[model samples]
Target: MFNKWQAQRWWSENYDRIKELYNVQRLNRNAFALPTPPISEDEASS
Candidate 1:
């Protein structure tokens, strides 16, 4: 259920909305916003 151009266009437009939703915003910020809160328990444990 995926088209190459359509997918590419999505990536080009939304960039990584899917990845962002999954919290995988590493290389792209066009669609994803970086996580600011601590992700590890070490900080909480401190």
Candidate 2:
């Protein structure tokens, strides 16, 4: 079984690599997402 110390050590070693991957994934998602058009005030009242 893995101990807490070992788990923490593993995360510490790989944190930056994992974080970089996560950031790339987020950027790709944002790049592909379409922007929503603003609704008119009149539409909100209906």
In candidate 1, which residue pairs get closer than 3 Å at backbone N, Cα or C atoms, i.e. clash? Answer: none
TM-scores, in order shown? 0.33, 0.45
The residue-level lDDT of candidate 1 at 19 comes to: 76
The number of clashing residue pairs in model 2 is 0
Global fold similarity of model 1 (TM-score): 0.33
Best by lDDT: 2
**Please, what are the lDDT tens digits per residue for candidate 2 over residues 1-46?**
6699999999999988998987744356578788998999999889
Provide the lDDT at 37 for model 1. 81
Model 1 CA lDDT for position 39: 60
Every candidate's lDDT: 0.74, 0.84
lDDT of 2: 0.84
Best by TM-score: 2
